[model samples]
Target: MAVGQVGGLLPHVAVPSTMPAFLIPEWGLSYGEAGLMASAYAIGYMLAAPVLTTLTDRIDARRILIFGSLLNALGTVGFGLLAEGMVSAMLLWGLTGLGFAGAYMPGLKALTDRLAPGDSSRSVTVYTGAFSFGVGLSFLACQLIADAFGWRWAFILTGLPPLIMTFVAWSLTPVTPAPRAGPLLDLAPALRNRTALGYSFAYGCHCFELYGVRTWLVAFWGFVAASGGAPLGAVVVSALFTALAMPASILGNELALKLGRHRAITLVMLLSAAVALAIGFTAGLSPWLTLMLMLVYAFTVPGDSGALTSGMAAAADPRFRGASMAVHSTVGFAFTAAGGWVIGVALDMAGGVSQPGAWALAYSVMAMGAALGPVFLWWSRRSGASS
Candidate 1:
């Protein structure tokens, strides 16, 4: 299933990967406009995740997973062939995000539902770790393919993998959840559960920072190279920055198990925020220093992911687990949608993406978002009185 997800995500960053080098030049897009196109995927997912994830409470998630995978393939391939400009690109990319709304959390629910009853904490953590791995591979693969075969084939070739995930979904043992006790869409219960809400909110803040950095990291690297920094493949650096998250997240989860989820997560977020500020104010002065800080930024940003998901899962009522995840993902992706676009707007306001000051301001924006995470986590514990 993890392998399938890896494949499903092959096209995850195809646009951003190609945007700096190809799509922006080809389509004559401004930074804000390009960011909007990048954000369309998260917006689509935010729109659809609630419905699809909520359905898993009373149905087999395998069905939704298969459907999402198909939609993902359609949207991705369609973009390769049919996307001629901004509007079409946003619509198609949004469709792909809609597809992921079905694939991601539903797939996780499917996996956990089929597991033997016990602590699935590590299992959940590892699954999210796979998400980072898949995204990292997307950055690497999409950029490489675009360089070799043009941007069209990058989307086209990457789009094919989700079809493989569709088949994987078909083979999963069917496991329909017991009939849920309330209205399918009643998220009020989830809202009232402050413990889960806290983790969800923190996850939202996390996504805001993580996706903002990711959406613009390649472009930032390009700016660095152009500004007399070391000449490097921006995409490769972006890939490495993201790929490091997998192990970092796993290790972070393990640390949480020992230090306590809240404590460990707070520490990581605080540290990450500090790094974000450092990167903003100082790192760009030297290419090697920037690379080091970026690698550290990667570790710190996703370090809380597994712990947050596990905390939310444990906090949610069993009967409404699906709905809980729905709320979690919806909030998270809403921030994800905003992250890229907000950073892009910041870039424009700060004197465009080419300037070192613009990059500094952008990273400062990421720091501001991350700094809010621990507050949410603390509020959850204080208000809910949950351990």
Candidate 2:
């Protein structure tokens, strides 16, 4: 189920990379408009997470996962076959995001409910680590399919895997009894847990930085690849970097255990922010060097992902697991959308996409959000203790 959960995301992330070559040119949309359309997916995710995932407290989460997977399959297929403009694309992608809201958190709840606390945390780390591989595959798959059979075919064919995943999850995954929390929609328990809320809100800051980086990474690499006359394409390099960096999330969770979650996340954010701070200034440097630095940023940035998630899930009251996840996704995805949109706006402000300095400033904004994460956690801790 975990593998399938990750498998489903493989094609979704591909849309960003393909939009430049396929969607924007064909649909006659600017990059800013395209980013906004992409933000629609985040909008859907934010809207759907609390309502859909909360159902797990009443019914088996496997059922929710199945429903979500079906929606994902339908949405992806709809995007491929029927979408003709930004509006249609936004609707389809939003539908897909609805599917993600159901699948991801519910899948986590289903698995964690059956495990020992220590084991559950480890499982969360490993499971979230699969996201890196999924995103990497998305980039690679989109490029390969688009090169062979055009971009429409790319979307159409890539949509099939999640459908297969729907079947895999429904037939093969074990069923667990529903968690009997207060009511199906009860979030009060989760909301009242200061620790859980802190971790969740911290996750929001991390999401801002993470999504911003992932969405624009290929675009940034395009300039570097062109400047170097590199044989490898931008998507390929970005995909490889994302894949190689996948294990860092798991390793980081281990660090959380040793150093404490807040400290570990804070340290990682500072390091990543430093890289984001410097990458822009060196925009005119050698493309090879730029790629190396991007790889560094990729590794450092994702390192805190699993740690943040594990911390939140661990701190949540058992009665409000679903609700905790609900708050986590709602806040996290709100920033996810904003991250993508702000990156677009940031690009426009920096003097459009053509200028190196603009790209430099835009890149800096991506990681700057995370630099505040430690401070947020520290202040929360102090306030709670004093009160």
Candidate 3:
């Protein structure tokens, strides 16, 4: 289950870290255009989530996995080969996002349905951990390939892993049938529920920060390196930060289990916001210090993601898990898309790379978003407690 889900996420991981730096220059794209490509992918995800979740209700997850994986591979390769302009890239990325929607949550549903009793949390942790591992590995792999070969090979090479995993998934996993009777998913009720809406708002804020940071971190580090007259190892630095984040994500999951999800999420968000705010003030310090701050920020920023998802899963009705996941993903990715655009506009408005302060301002906005997540989550908990 871990392998299957991670395979699907590999492309997502690779694109954010490497593609912005590598592709923007290679493809002659403006910052706004590049941002739109990223947003286009998330738009695709938003479109597919509810539709794919509904399909999962009627079909076998294993088959869905295979189909999704194939589409992901094809779409990723297509992006490398055919993406000439912003429109073409966005179209292909949209396809990639659609494929991803099918693979991620459906794979989890399959795993949970097949649990051998008393292993739900453990199974969930393992699944989420695999996702983080895949993301880190993909970043590392893309950096290596782009450094050695070129940017296009990064996409081409990463596509092969999911293809292989798709076959493995089909052979190992069993089919699952739809449930017989339940309340049909009505968006109105989920939207009206204060707890669900609060959780969704928190997740949106989290994604706004997380995705913006991930998309721009390499560029930000590169600016710092160039200004400091340091070596051009920004990609390597970015890769290291992402690598550190993988273990942190696993640790975060365990911390959430021990400390309570709400508290754990709040702590991590506070730390992340502080680090992001401090990075600009400390940029003139030694290179190692800047890197350390970035590493710390990356490690903590995404720490609460699985916890937020777990909270949503726990709060949802069993019959409506698919719909709940759909809504969660749609809102989260929508915010991510907005973040990408905001970062791009901020960069462009500040004029070219001449101003590191612009990047600082962008990150500060992201940090503020992260800081707000805990407030909404706390409000939700208070409402629940009072009720």
Candidate 4:
């Protein structure tokens, strides 16, 4: 499961970190256009999540995962060959997102369906945590491949991993029987359930902040370098930050389990938002200090990640796990799909990369998601969440 997820993220991040540099000169794209391409994956994810993930309740998720992998591989290859403008980039990356929707939640559904009761929280935390490392490799891979050959080969090579993962997962993982639960795709139970809704809503905020940071971190690093101090480069810094975040996800989940989920998420989200609010202005600070701050910020941002999913999983109706996940994914990824373009628009409005205020405003907008998290938690508590 972990390995397949790692493979899944490869195609997703293959372009975002490098696309602006590679395509801007060649395609004459603006920052907003570039940001749209970054958001395209999430757009595709939001579009496909409800149906694809819900179908796992009635069908083998492994089968869906294979189909998704095939779509991602094809999309990656298509991008390598066909991406020339913003439209093409968004369409192709959107396809990548659609493919991802299959692998992610369906894969989770598969794992949870098989696990014994009480075992899923720890298992789910590990699985969710793997996404960070997977993306770290995606950034590192894009950097190395682009340096060695060209930008296109990064997609071409990363694209193959999903195809390979499909076969490997098919052969190795247990074939979970499809759920006999009637109204397999109905989401009413989850929607009407406050505990489930709380986790799902919190996940939306998490994705809003998480994907926004990830999509723009590399470019933001470059802007920082140009503004004042240089810290290695965007690619290296992004990869390092994501790599460190892998451990933080698991640690955060365990901490939340010990500290109580509601308190942990509220504390972590507010603290992370505070750091995010401050981080944009630190570009002109000492390079080492800025880098350290970034590392800490990265840790804090993903700190609630595993906790959110595990919380939702714990709160979900057993018969409607797939449907609950569908709702969770749809709500979460909707903001993720919009995050990049919103930041770009904010950046342009604030006077592009030249003005420190632009970056600050844009990052603050992203941090708003985190800031809203505590509010949701409060509402959930007030509303009488079951979990």
Error of 1 at 34 (Å): 1.1
Model 4: ten consecutive residues of lowest lDDT? 172-181
Q: Candidate 1: where are CA atoms >4 Å away?
A: 229-231
The positional error of residue 295 in candidate 4, measured at the CA in angstroms, is 0.5
Which candidate should be chosen as best, given lDDT against the real structure?
Answer: 1
Each candidate structure's TM-score, on Cα atoms with residue i matched to residue i, is 0.98, 0.95, 0.90, 0.96
Report the lDDT tens digits of candidate 4 across residue range 78-142: 88888888888889989988998888898898788778988998999889988899999899898
Order of candidate numbers by TM-score, starting with the best: 1, 4, 2, 3
Distance from true location, Cα of 240 in model 1, Å: 0.8
In candidate 2, list every pair of residues with a backbone clash. Answer: none
The CA lDDT of each predicted structure is: 0.91, 0.79, 0.73, 0.83
Error of 2 at 62 (Å): 0.4
Better candidate by lDDT, 2 or 4: 4
lDDT of 2 by residue, 308-344 (tens): 8888888887767888989888989998898878887
Error of 1 at 308 (Å): 0.6
Residues 1-387 of candidate 3: C-alpha lDDT, one tens digit per residue: 777666666677555656556778777877767777877777887787776765555566667667778888888888777777677878998998888867777677667667754676666666766776676677677778878887777877787677765876677656557564553445554564566656677888888987787777667777778667554476676666666655676788789889987788899988888898888666645667777787788688778777776667666566566667667777888888888878878778776444767766777788888999989888887887211
Better of 2 and 3 by TM-score: 2
State which candidate has the highest TM-score: 1
